[model samples]
Target: MEDEILGKAYDGRLMRRLLAYLRPYRGQAIVALVATIAASALALVQPYLMKVAIDRYIAQGDLAGLNTIAVLFLLVLVGSLAFEYVQTFIMQMIGQRIMFDMRMQIYGHLQRLDLRFYDRNPVGRLMTRVTTDVDVLNDLFTSGVIAVFDDVFTLAGIMVVLLVMNWKLALVSFSVLPLIVLVTQWFRRNVRDSYRTVRVWIARINAYLQENISGMSTVQLFRREAQNYARFDEIDRGHRDANVASIFYYAVFYPAIEVVGALAASLIIWYGGGRVIQGALTLGSLVAFIQYSSRFYRPISDMSEKFNLLQAAMASSERIFALLDTRVVVENPAAPRQAAGGSGHIVFDHVWFAYRGEDWVLRDVSFEVAPGERVAIVGATGAGKSTIVNLLLRFYDVGRGRILVDGVDIREMELDALRRLFSLVLQDVQLFSGTIASNIRLGNTDITDAQVRSAADAVHAGRFIDRLPQGFDTAVAERGATLSVGQKQLLSFARALAFAPQILVLDEATSSVDTETELLIRDALRVLMGGRTTVAIAHRLSTIQDMDKILVLHKGEVRESGSHQQLLAARGIYYRLYQLQYRDQELRAVARTDAR
Candidate 1:
């Protein structure tokens, strides 16, 4: 949750980097610029027209020109307003479109980043880049860049008009411009800092809130609710302080500029009146010079505010570009590599892997599962049991060796196509936020209600599902909280059945079920796994006792591989593991009998 850009908000290089997004919307942006130039040009004519009307009609008695001049002035005003509207509308549309495309690109990039990125970065921080970061871009384009264009043209035209009318009065009036620019730029810098602080504290608050709410149950269980609330209060107060400081700067900015502007106007009037009385300058020209002075520095005030928004946007841009630059490590082969004969035969030739390349988690692991045959992987904690499955699924690639499916290297196949070949029931079943039937048919568009019911029946889950109020359509609460652990496992079983995959993987599928329920589901699993390439990771050795072959692993390598009776006769690692689970089962049965 630490601030990513607290010290870098005002970096010129970083700010310039953000402007790159404007390139894509350049065509419409040009139209907005043209509109602004037209509007500012039209605005500069008003002051001169007023000067001519004052001296010509009143002093020279030229009343005949008034009606025509008034009509032309009205036309200019109407045209200027139309151009202003079009400019604002078009710039806003272009900015919004850029934001839309930027979000899509960032989101697509996020999807491709490896899972390890999420493990390191907080979700709240990433969300800030999308929501608040995009909002800053909106402000910069609408309220910042557009204002800069308007101010530049208006000030330049006004300065030219002032020099043409009376240079002496213009010189005296603009004496205060230096102080105004200095004070306004100072205020803008401070405001940008305060806003940066505000964004940082807000991200901290979001991170704290997300962690607290998602782990609410753990806090209650540990009686740490009071501690979490106190931490939240600290984060909230930091955000409030940052906000109040930003407001203080904004409150002082406008009034300070007003004082400076009024001072300049007073000096203009004092010198211009003397010149007019002495016949050094005409009254009409002196009046026009005063108007020009007012119009020139008007954009200074605008530029000050726009600069503040630009700084915040640059901070956001840095984070977004960083995300887009992340490289996706997993990719399909350049040329398609299809399975040979498509029988789903799997072979691991000396597979070895480590997440960080620091420890040898899986070492020289080799096994082969024939098509339409069943094999079980058995190991203790940290024994590379799940690692094997992760490799097969390509969640991570094997570091040292080749894994082949149907005589073709799995790495050469498309990730999605490879995954679609298998139906998996993980030990930790993840039931999404959807109805029971919908969860079972995830990503499967062709699964019918009848098919869903059959899958449920095959797993012996229909009994409990049929008892529910909504039956197949019943909503599973977040992570299936409303159902028992066994019920969730049953739903996972039904989901796997619906996939009808060529290869089936069941990782401790019966561990959560009660003995009675387990017996029924075990029979169902046996039938489902029949005539498929089945790979099972089981802790309860009994579940795999009837598997066609068993692989017993220790540390990172396989210690034994044989049939159930063959491994038992070896009196090795598999023998000891079988003996342990068998003794535990006996003890559990005796305890149940004595209690009854």
Candidate 2:
């Protein structure tokens, strides 16, 4: 589990990058900005109107003048409310659109990334990037950024209005401005660090919860519930402490603003009241000075809150950009060459590979499978059997040497065209939650219902599929939890058959089925492998006995290559493996006979 890297409080580079996403929605953003300025100007008008009403109508007892000022004030109030609503709505629309684009771009990039990237990163952390990190950016767009403009405009407008009315009194009312600035700056500095802590803890909590919940069954099976709960509580406590620290900064800052506001108001009354009495300033002007001063502090306080949001959004943007900036290790060639033939002739020319640098998993392993031939790779658990499949599929590019498909170097061929040559069925069959037919078609609309059923029938999966309540239309649970292991394997075969690839790769496909189901699968395999080049990774010696060729691997090197009887006579790695499996089966049979 990796911790987040903390960034600068105000990163100009990141801000510029974030603004580029808003370029497509420039029209909406401009409209929202105009609405913000208009609303702020409208709000500024009411206090000035009040000043006029007092000076021209209330003191002189002019009834018509008072009525007129009252109507103007009411009109400005209504207009301000309407413009504020429009600004908020437009900003929200822009935020949602930007979020949509960002999420789609991130998800699409993840799909193109090599398997090596996924092997290093966790699903939970990536989920946070697409869901929670993107959401924080949305808040910045909808509230933090636009509200910043509104606050500055409102504060500047009030300053200009106060000076024009009475510079001396305005200067007196502005006496508390220095203290407010000092307090806000101090608060921003402290809260920025606190907010970063909160964001980190949030990511940690998400990672922990996702991993534990996903593996809950394993936790229960091992009876580690109490210990797991204690670990989770420790993580959760750190998150709570982080939040409390941020709350403390907010608690101190908001009240500090209120105190500064009251002090400024008191100063204005003391200075403006004596001036009014001395006949230098009118009562209305004195009252208006107080109103403008309060207005000034309100924006400052609101801006303080927006600063908190900005800090959190900045941290999230750093993480999001880091993900987007990751270079795709495996990419298609710019000017790709085509394969010579479409017969699925695969040749590994001394291939070498590793998930990470220098620590090799496959070391100078070489083999070839001719067109329409069946080849089986037998190896111990960590003997690089699956690495062969991974490298052939270009999941991770070979660290050295090259692979050829149909006489063309795989690196020179387009990735999509290279992958389309083979149909892969893994040890763990992944079936989505959809109908049996949909699972067989697997989002390729070209695979018709007739084709799906024919493939299912060919693999003998149609027998069980037809017996279901809705036949092929029956829905599968997530990962096919509702189906048995053999049933899932049969559906996988149906899927591979429906795709109709020239080469078939099976990674321990029949290792998990029962004896009866294995018989069914063996019969199906004959039909499935008919005239198609097949490469199988098998642990069971009986399954690959009739394969056209056998490659025995030990510690990432091929030690033997021959037919079953031929390898047995050679008395190498394969012969010892056969003897071990045979002896184990014989012991199981003897035990069963004694029990009877």
Candidate 3:
């Protein structure tokens, strides 16, 4: 876990990749840099102006010169404020724009990635990539990168002015520099590891919180509240402890620098005061040396904090680049075939597939469906029924053999174009937060409200939708929580119909709805399936009795295939399944008679 939590503190490759994202905002970045430099230069002016006021006006008792210098000091203060404001504003704009670009890029890449990628990663982990991980980079941009330049320039300006003012006093103030370096190095080493720990714990916290909130119903139903809370407490405590550890290093480092800075100031005062008394240094020069020394340490303290942000940014960049570098295993062919409309000639020839190494889910499976044919595949759980649908949709490429639509290999077709040929309704329906009409139309603005209403009405979803206060404009809660299982299922049917694909695939689509809703869905299915190539997976054998062909699969292979009556007459796998389901009444009657 520790090995996974931390990577190299600085990675050049990751930094280069991160810098590429900034290229688009280079104009703003350049402006911010210029502003920071101007600001730093202006910052040196006030101390020098004070020195001028003390030496040329106060010592000579020239009231006019004193008043003029005072006004010049205020002017330099305003100039410094303006430059600082511009620097901050420009940096924040660049940071926000870069963040937007990164979030979109990550989200877009995620959408293009095949299902296999999602199967391996948790939702919370991906969410972190787009949100928290990107946020860390924002700090790196605003405070870590450009601000480092600001701090360095300010420190350099102070050093130059101090050395020119009085070299002996400057050397005395620089005496504590080696100690500050040593303390900062120690703080950096400890804080780097602590920050890694904090990030890891926060990721864990996000994963736990997301999972528990999503499954809160299950936890409550199982009375696992106490156990879940204990688990959450453990994770939350880890996060707190990691943060506390990081804070501990910061706490130590800041005060250590302050003490060292005070020591430097004391040395400057002691040495420079003696020089002034000996007439070796002006009194104004001694005061200016002390002011510059303090200013020098301020930047050192700031750079120390920025160093922490830099380290955290390095880690975040590593994770973000790693995600971006993930190979898109399933890619569109360079020259895709534009197959004619789904004359729905689908053929799976000697196909084999596996989610992981060598553990085949579908082995040597072969089948064909001509246009406008309805085929039903019956199987127990894990018989690879849904794998067939997955392959047809090109969600996962087969490990062996090929799937063809209209005599062309599916891998040769553009994914979106191929998917457009079929409409799939799964056992579970997913609905986003939107109005009923928008949900039906999805993002296709070309699908007018009239078309959306027509599809919903055809699917019998319009009945309940019409009853709602807002009707088609009614808001859908997340995952359609405001809608019933049956109502949501109807919306799924409406969605599929709205697309009007040539092939319709149903995976136990009505399994969760009530009997009344099932009748309405069956009616909609009949109308939707008409003149379309249909593949249905059903647990209720009665529903598929009228299908043109029925394939009975036991494991990964087709054990039997024929019409409903013929397969039953064959007295094979299909026969057994039918008997088990439909013969229950007869068997129960026989048992009752035997008991009498």
Q: RMSD per prediction, one decimal?
A: 2.8, 1.7, 2.3
TM-score of predicted structure 2: 0.96
What value of lDDT does candidate 1 attain over all alpha carbons?
A: 0.83
Q: List the residue pairs that clash in candidate 3.
A: none
CA deviation > 4 Å runs, candidate 1? 1-3, 6-24, 58-70, 282-287, 475-481
Q: Rank by lDDT, descending? A: 2, 3, 1
Output candidate 1 Cα RMSD: 2.8
Give per-residue CA lDDT, model 3, range 457-519, as digits (tens): 998999999999899999999988998888888998999999898999999976867779999
Residue 380 miss distance in model 1 (angstroms):
1.9
- Top candidate on lDDT is 2
Scored against the true structure, residue 367 in model 2 reaches a CA lDDT of: 88
Better of 1 and 3 by lDDT: 3
- Residue ranges of candidate 3 with Cα displaced over 4 Å: 1-4, 585-596
Q: Give Cα distance to truth, residue 224, candidate 2, Å.
A: 2.2
